[model samples]
Target chain A: MSEYQLPAQFEEFSQARKEGFLRAKAIKDSGGHIAGTFCTFTPCELMDAAGVHPVSLCGMSPEPIPAAEKDLPKNLCPLIKSSYGFAVSDTCPYTYFSDLIVGETTCDGKKKMYELLGRMKDVYILQLPQGIDRSYALEMWTKELHRFKAALEEKFNVTITDQALREAAELRNQLRQARTALMELQKLDPPPFTGLGLYKLLDGLGFSFDLHSNLKKLTDLTAQLQADYAAGARPVPPGQKRILVTGCPIGGVLEKTVKVVEENGGVVVCFENCGGIKPTRYLVDTQAEDIMSAIAQRYLNIGCAVMTPNSQRMELLPQLVEEFRVDGILEIELQTCHPYTVERYEIKKLAHDMGVPFLALDTDYSQSDVGQLTTRIAAFIEML
Target chain B: MPVYSIGVDIGSTCAKLAVVEDGRTLVHQMVMPTGWSSAETAQAIYDQLERQGYCPDSSPCVATGYGRLNVPYAQKTVTEITCHAKGAAFLFGTEACAIIDIGGQDTKVIAMADGVVQDFLMNDKCSAGTGRFLEIMANTLCVDPGTLCELARRGSGVSISSMCTVFAESEVISLIGSGTAKEDIAYGIVESIVNKVASQYGKLSVPGDRCYLTGGLCESPYILESLSRTLGLTVTSHPLARYAGAIGAALTAHGLARSERRTSV
Candidate 1:
């Protein structure tokens, strides 16, 4: 149990990705559990909650998913082809690290992707609905929780008892509070918090941590900040206009973009992104019928037009706009993320139509190239 | 009463839309993001168009792109290849021209004779030579597209093998960490992108009066020079060539305008 399982050959993330290529070169060359996941952008916290190490999974190459191709239509998104490319080529990373493959209905392709990978040893899908309804969200999240618990229990031969839930809940609550505090800090005039700090806080918000003190410490920090914030000691940065940022995961340089706004006297009030909200918002209620449902419900709180894209968000954004009195809108679109790009278009027009200044910044997902965002964000603030 | 035609190019990365009034370019252009639902894409395209005085209520529209299926209000949808050829013909006369269009999501090499498509090869699977590729390389090199191209022009050393953004980004990082010259990597990177492009674009099959380059990558001189050098062909480009697709769509509208006038006459 204590022995290191690092492959003698595979090293680094790319090596790990290509290990299947090596393994597939000859069937008898390697023997171990193989798994494939969609991509690195989505890091399922639930897998960590179950004490399972989750890795970003993809198929062998960007080739079409052969099995689904005939039925899925030729013009289907390239992402689908890449998904099918995993199993059909057998050089899929999922072929190695996965004893049981779990898929989410994030997209139509991924939702139906499991059927194409039917050759996989055991495929477990946590059936997710198309849209995000609050009640349904709760139910869905809870179902995932129970299912994950069952799977983890079976895999590890250990029970995910109520105590574990409470413990995990408390720790997660600490992370959530930290995130909420960071959101509050962004409201500070001159913008004290950066996207990098928020990213760091959310980096592990979904997992179960055994340390009670760690969460309590963060909770204390938030409480202190709240008290300080209430006393009006930390005034909203002087002359700064408040704005709500809506986008997918801010690639590497989101900090630069935020800085651009801050430098121009605009403070970011809330971050509406899958990366920004998913980790901080996905805190499961320990007492629920299904923990996964609670997680999904919490996920909905971030107001993603995806995950759940109806009334709650429509109401929430306007409310946030009014409550925060945000002067403008900045929608950052990572080049590859079509979902956010589409959404930004809607948000931009809505913002402009409503007389709120709207601007969109499209960039790649690398960290250091953030200066471009800084310039545009600063310009946006200036215009506002 | 004067007539108006709205043309939309539902590009891979962005939707380029233009409005023409009475066969004259009103030039109501929109560059909006794309993806998500077809409804969402159409809504976005329409909403952006609204900003330019062309609303669903006011003007007739045409749509084109890989995502033409998403544009709701279009009277018709045409391929960008056809649109680019039409646009190119209007710009450089409808003689013989080979179209090299590097859009956000896809790269297309089109042969046009008499302002129409003869044949074409498109590379859409991986965005190696497209606008997306430029964005990625720019991000990797920590520069804007203009600067990234300039850096590539400085040195012709090094080699980039992978076309995958995920892998290529890592490769660039590792190379940089190992003290590879920034410009050399940039040169190699652009070269590699153009190489992937050439692989997909089987051969430059055309009756070459002139090989006209248009689309997003038309702005990347480094890529253009590298492609031309690799394929041993001289390329021609014009200012505002990014508008080729939109211009082409407008040209098609102009053709429609003429046909309708003849019927009225």
Candidate 2:
């Protein structure tokens, strides 16, 4: 129904998106324990090393939020409500089949929702330290990572050896490398990818357990993108501005904004959310003597707004802006998301300092504001 | 012997059309309620304009506003934010200003400089600050929109604090039931709309003091007076403020047509 049709290769991912849970189901049936995580801070290497299937459990649909309202408040963050909604309604097999649901203390809404989720399934809480500059923060997170590794060993009854950790690290690094390689294609004029297309491919990483197959698909897709470029094929036409979206992660459930951005004549070239480049772009230094500590160091450097004094994020943005050739920045903060909302002013100031057009929009998962949201986004594109 | 570029703005409550010739002149303008069929209304307006000797094949047509996608013949669709800036700059000549557009379902505070849009913000999903909210309150008071604005102008000030439109309507009904004067309640409704708009405007970080009001709400004198008083700044509207979106769309169409002609040449 969108005015702009997605390129064929990206459309292929849409088919894969439909069978996401089935793939997870297949993995579960094959004697693999599925480990579901709420935040990207849950290192995939730890779970994979224990022969567990790691899947992201963030909910994207609003239909189940009413079911969630029985126990949760009506005005709670929509993502949290929708996630709990999926859990209660048994709509998400990933959550239902998860042997362990890993949660991080990224925000209060997710924290509280995870507490409620613990009643329904086995939940392991990751106590994330705020403000990386604090003297003991890195040490504290390192200890937490060890505890997390131990939990995986105890829950799965398999002692994780350094060799397995190294192997898992190598596997995940390959997946990350494939994703980062795909992202570089955005720097080209008339980016050979759509935001919706790129999102579908990256989101596949959340549910997919087999890194080698994903790398093959990505490698093949990248070749096709390069061929398209050589053949003078591009998804977005000239005069359409490139946008970099920053804010809440739009996972399986919260994807309308990306579609809306593309529909409104803007091509999303980069995403600063956890779902995109931030977590996947970095890799664990496998050569480090302690792979557990190396994984901790890598994730700790993630510049989420939950971190106090997130200067690394602020420092990284301008470089991304130049690298991606962004014409504007669209910062979307979900309703009741306090940390991102509080930090919105700083992002706004950054946009102004960089002299790029900016629009900070706050929305929930409800379809009511789609019209208004489209208008604002269109106007922002027109500005560019 | 001149071709006229056309722009149609199919808004939530009204559909507007503007025809421009020679890249500058506003040849014709039409405004009507959007009704159920935006595409039909836009087509009918286009037909009427075509009867006046405008050739469509040589001219570009642009559509904008909430129902923009429904405009069947649009060569391009732009957002009302761009249209408003273009329209305001045309009327006011590139002055650094904020264009405050209060439409049926939304209110947009757009910051512009040198005839270009720099930034903008729109009311969230709520209808509390929009023209539709005022229209609903007007219906409950058994008064037409024009009379309600006039009544507010003469009535004593009464505070109305409910943010949700449905609750605010209930609050209005209670005031009438409690022997409060209709005129006072009418004044409160106007103040409520003004308060909502002011709060949204306060959140804009774009630096500007000169504010221009556009959209159908500009026809309401009380809102303009209230806006000026609340913001403590000079607020003005172009004589054709209601046609801003259509005019901007028409201007863009003209530019597009010129580019096409140049490409062909």
lDDT of 1 by residue, A1-384 (tens): 322243443454476456544543332223323233453222244544555444434432334346545555555444455556544544444344355666765655556667766664566666555565545655665566577668766875656655555555655566666666656566555445444455545443322123355466666656776677676664454667777877645534455576556555666777765555334644556677755555555544545544546444455556557655678877766544556666765675577566776667665433434433443454345345
Tens digits of per-residue lDDT for model 2, A1-384: 323222233333445543655566566666778888878788878888888887877888787899999999998778889889978877676876788999999898899888999898999998999878988887898899889889999989998889998999998888788888898798887898888888887776555566788889888888899998999886677656899989887663345577777876778899888877787777899999878888888888888999889886798788889999999998888888899999998998998899888888788888777777777776777788
Model 2 lDDT vs. the true structure? 0.82
The regions of model 2 sitting more than 4 angstroms off are: A1-25, A252-255, B50-59, B206-208, B258-265
Residue A352 lDDT, candidate 2, scale 0-100 = 85
Clashes counted in candidate 2 amount to 2
Report the lDDT tens digits of candidate 1 across residue range B1-265. Answer: 6667777777767767766667665556666666656568778767766765555544556566666656666655556767777777766665677878877766777776665565556663456767787788788788987788789899766887777877888888899899998898888877877787667555545766477777766666767687788767877677667777777666566545332211100
DockQ of candidate 1, scored on C-alphas against the true complex (2 decimals): 0.02
Indicate which candidate wins on DockQ. 2
